[model samples]
Target: MNENLQSSIEFSHESGFDPFMESEFHDSLKKKNPDIVINLISSGLHKSSEKYAEIFADIGSSFINATHTSIAINESFIKTFKDKKLIV
Candidate 1:
């Protein structure tokens, strides 16, 4: 299964960067120009509401920022690939 999946798809790995930094994030996005982006970061997953609030004053905002940035960065590319979906 892993071999089949690998043969059918191309995957790239990047790490050691903070998504909150718009410039760095955007630069990576522009470089990759991926057709799909799956955001697996769950902010405040097991924490209480108060704790979550205290921990992240603006939780989930980064996802939104990433999504918008992806759209903006891939505007022209998306126009070409009309069926492509941006799942950030």
Candidate 2:
């Protein structure tokens, strides 16, 4: 990577917050006010078939929370992208 490109990048990490908690997740988003958000949360791996409903619920809720928070912060930032593609 070019030194200039690397120097322009910024990263932040916050610990001990549960994304499933709507209020906590919204609060974190409001605090960060990030230009882009890439949510990689998943609960579908290695689970038994009996837990499919729970897994689906978890993913659904997560997606809803992320979408709501992002729209609340900046509606213009919402755009569909191909998998793993980060738009600037």
Candidate 3:
């Protein structure tokens, strides 16, 4: 997944946001000014996933999904990126 995410970031950085990208989930977010963003991160525990999460955090977006069975994004990671929002 890290490799995939690295590749994805490379592509996104090179080509701009993909209208068809899965994170388009943020579309609704842009509408309501969501304060929390729940997403599946357990499946993304790999190095690249962590890297991608860091990038997302830099942009003020936290990812939480069904995979986040604990109902919380990692506090340590969250603290590093203050603006990013999280949801359960």
Question: Which structure among the candidates has the greatest TM-score?
Answer: 3
Instruction: Return the TM-score for candidate 2, rounded to 2 decimals.
Output: 0.26
**Ranked by TM-score, top first:** 3, 1, 2
- TM-score result, candidate 3: 0.35
Off by over 4 Å in 2: 1-20, 43-88
Q: What are the per-residue Cα lDDT tens digits for candidate 3 across 1-88? A: 3684443333344657664464552443343443444444666455545554554554566555445233236676767665444432
Q: How do the predictions measure up, each by TM-score?
A: 0.28, 0.26, 0.35
The lDDT, on a scale of 0 to 1, for candidate 2 is 0.33
lDDT per model vs. reference: 0.34, 0.33, 0.48
Q: Which stretches of candidate 3 lie over 4 Å from their true place?
A: 1-45, 65-73, 81-88
RMSD each, Å: 13.3, 13.6, 8.4
Can you write out model 1's per-residue Cα lDDT over 1-88, one digit (the tens) per residue? 2584334433333755553454553444445444443332344342332222222222221122222224334454334333333221
Error of 1 at 68 (Å): 18
Model 2 lDDT tens row, 1-88: 3584334433233756543555544444445444443332343432332132222232332122222123223333223221223341
User: Which scores greater on TM-score, model 1 or model 2?
Assistant: 1
Local error of candidate 1 at 54, Å? 23
